[model samples]
Target: MAFTQIEDYGVIGNLETCPLIGNDGSIDWCCFPHIESSSVFAGILDDDGGGHFAIQPSGEFESAQEYVTRTNVLRTTFETDSGTMTLTDFMPVVDGVELGHTTSAIYRKVTCTEGTIELDATFEPRFDYDRVGTTVEQTSEGVIARGNGEQLYLWSPADFESSEGEEEHAEATETLRADETMWFVLQYNDREPIDAADCAALLRETIDYWQDWTHQCLDASGCPFEGPYHDDVIRSGLVLRLLMNPQTHAIAAAPTTSLPEEVGGVRNWDYRYAWIRDVSYTIQALNELGHEREARNGFDWCLTMCHKDDPGEIGHPLYGLHYPPEMVEEELDHFSGYRHSKPVRIGNAAGDQQQLDTYGELITAIYTATDYGEEIFAGEWEVIEEVIDHVSGVWTNKDKGIWEVRSEPKHVVHSKALCWAALDRGIKIAEDNDFDAPIDRWKGERDTIRETVLEEGFDEELGCFTQTFEGETVDAAALRLGSVGLLPFDDDRMQSTIDAVMDHLMTDEGLVMRYEGDDGLPGEEGAFVLCSYWLVECLALSGRVEEAHDVFESATEHLSPIGLFAEEIDPETGEHRGNFPQAFSHIGLINAVLYLNQAEPGETLDPIGRGATEITTDSKS
Candidate 1:
């Protein structure tokens, strides 16, 4: 079996975990029960060793995949020589229900639309990342695969036969005429059989749930959901929502992990966990769409994570969905990585690294939420004060920057600017709500940080801000200094930084790389998707709407056929790299659209950063 290209997949989920269904009618990657769990199907990582669940035509056929308009439910159509058939896939989800109570089942409904077609189905289970042995037994309903102390129940009407010399595999073949339908449900732990009526009702409910959620984006007050990029904006918004756990309000960076940033390279990392910086940006984007409830829920979750027993202690850069005790990175050496990128990792080691910029990202998100009328409670205020105080004392310290570089710590300019933003926003929150705080000291520290960055973090010769203090290398992160309100978009230094980044770090495709210099990692990565969107936001706010639009189009031109983005994109071939359906990339697209919607041609717009006096509330008619 050959590995499917990363871009040839669409995702379907129940707000907890998702399965990546390939265009060729295969679920190549899936994590059972939760996004971070060991994979039940990991064919994308190792084609031969990893197990997979596939349903495709018996003979050669042409296939295409798409979403069920505005919903995460996916449909793949196969056109065979004799007939055309459609396979609709979705995970059952109940609106307003907690994750613990929702059904953890995947439903695939196959219908022949024209003539006759023969479908072959394969069910292979590899529990515990294929480390433990799995045994499958025939049952009245279908078959049960048990391994690693867990059981998977497949409820199907078609008769399945055990594969030759393979007890862990089941195969089935069926021929259907026009209008004939078949249903297959893969459930976790449960053994209750479901009829066609139950499957039909679940499908309807799932579709309605997603459509209603998408409607909220349209009905949102002050949302600019309508425009030339309306479809793209809505699609991005839905992708972000799919990564969010509806019950805990915890959002994953992406569903699958270890999808290499560079194919056949060693730049792969797991993105199943939620990052503080990524969630903060997601809140801002959702807030811009007038989804204040989701924004507030996410903010509340972040604050909960920030509560610490030790005074002035800050949380890790990222956390699991339920705030696990530890996320120790582990490699499954048995399975070859996607496209032979070795060392398929499950957990993340970067969670232990110190990323100081998280304080500013958190506080900026709090300030943005409050500006939109989300109340800040006394306890959350206490946590905010603790975070601000910590930043005040350590703003000058060197640590791992936003890129999470593994090299020696340096005075990264982006980190310093964000520290300034934290202080600035803290002072504003205290002043606005009349909350008691050390206003004078915060102001002093904030000013010192700003002056220090402007002086030491800039290169006079290059006329632009450098990646590090007195460093010569330019970084795409510099584009965010203006968006964070550390500098005005029209400031000469910021303009120079943007120009320098474009001249140095941008690809010929107009997509921006995170940085040009080394980051203590082997193998090169593709253009960072979020960085390119940052360039778009910076240009739009600087009154260069046309130029911004051009970059925005270029940045989004390589979206998956179903309108999803990965963590990075190959500038040369336009292929997706890194984790699929990255939340940060979608957030960047949504925010860029929001910024562009408010920008007046040739007129500088107010910075939509921590210092912004008002939130943009231009309603969509």
Candidate 2:
């Protein structure tokens, strides 16, 4: 099997879970039942033990892949020596508003568009993360691969034969002329077998469903985003939605884990779990783009996760998708890593670490969604108060920062700024709704946090706000002060800090690094993509419109062909690093575009809202 670069894959999902379909026609990585579940196909991580399902031309062929317009359905064209064939891939969904709640089946239709072409289909599933082998059993309907309490059934119109001894693997070879079509359906869990006609009908319905949803985005008239990357913005929004869990409305940071921040390095971590701070950022971006309903759904999901039976035991920085409290880190020693990036991790330890920034993120998300006139339940309001009380009590202490640093605790500047934001937004929420208690106390704490950040987080000698209190390390998080409303974007102090961070922490290739300081990690990582977008937003807000445009262009120049981005980018190689199709990166992109477009002179733009709260059309004229 030929291995492709991580960027060569396009993602297709059922809103429950997704699979990464490579340009070469391979489903590289996928987790079923839920995003965090063990992968049935882990070839993206370990080609041998990590089984894969692939359909491609038998002979050598050149291939190109793309998503069907306005939908998650993917189409890969294979040009063989004698002919051409196209493979259409999508997970089936029910009709209407129920489209998001999808069935556990992947529908693939293969057709020859040119002369006669020979096609090959391979089904190899790794059960229990390859801890056990799946035994393939042939039946009248098709073939079923069963192992470890998971059963994946395959039904195809073409003849199937056992490739390995004892029918451990199933393969099909068929020749089709122009206008000929064949169907393959891969079903997981409890599902009824379907025929080719039903598969074709479901495919059409799925395409229509996605197309209608994309049309509903803010792209209609009065939509603010009209720029060089308009289509990219829409596509990123779709990718973010694809990462969301339909049942809980909780969004995963990414679909895959252990893809590596640096090849041949140990920076791999599982990103399938939901992080409160990450979801909060995602919601804010969606809300700014006029996807208010989706944003509120996500925020409401976070509220539900935090509000357990015990109100005192409120929120954690991160949680598993199904099991919120038990995020135990585990290493898979049996499987090889992606391109030799070692120690494939399962769960995240960051869930247990006390990151003080989460409170502020939750409050800001709720306040932003509510400000958009979306209704908030009384139960949500109670959770908001509990979070506020928690922040007021714990802002002074620090365990882990936003980066989830494994180092000793220090007063991280970003965490403190977020704590201030929590109080600041809480006060605003209280005043806006006239629902209150401890108004003066909240005000004093907010002001105290502001003063402390100004005094201790800033380094006069360096002319920038440091990463931690009284520390000299410049970080990209400083650029976010404007977004959180902690500082005026054009304030001289803030400008100095931005300039300093860009000067010291940015790569020669114009990409921003998260931080240049050591955090007890072994290998060096790539420039952070989210931070690059933050620089874009910060520059636009500070009145450097042209510079911001230039920076935005440079930052997005090397994204995936489909405009997807990973968490980080290697400046030298221009390859995606860390988890692929990262939510934070796309969220940053959408918010930055909104900030730039809404930043016209005489028009005041709210960075959080991503649009003018008041357009001031008369002043513009």
Candidate 2 Cα errors over 4 Å, as ranges: 96-101, 163-167, 215-221, 309-315, 377-379, 601-605, 610-621
lDDT tens digits, residue span 1-621, model 2: 656788889998888888998988888887887678888999998877788999999989999888888788899999998999999999876563334556887888899999999988888888878888678867776778888899998887778876555327888889999999988888998658587778888888888877877625445466767777778888898898788776677788999989999999999999987888777778767765666667878877867855766533433577766654458899999778998889999888877777878777777777766767766566666767777877788899865788888888889899898888888888877776777558799888888887888888888898988899846899888776667877766566778888997799778888888987789779989999989898888888777777788778878886898778989999899999999899999888887888888776433245754221121222111
Best by TM-score: 1
The lDDT of each candidate is 0.84, 0.80
lDDT of 1 by residue, 445-536 (tens): 98899789877988878778888984688888888788887777767788888899889988999999999778898889999999999999
Give, for candidate 1, the lowest lDDT window spanning 10 residues: 612-621
What TM-score fits each model? 0.96, 0.94
Residue 496 of candidate 2: its Cα lDDT? 88
Model 1, CA-based lDDT: 0.84
Which ranges of candidate 1 are over 4 A from the true structure? Answer: 164-167, 216-223, 311-315, 612-621
Instruction: Give the count of colliding residue pairs in each prediction.
Output: 0, 0
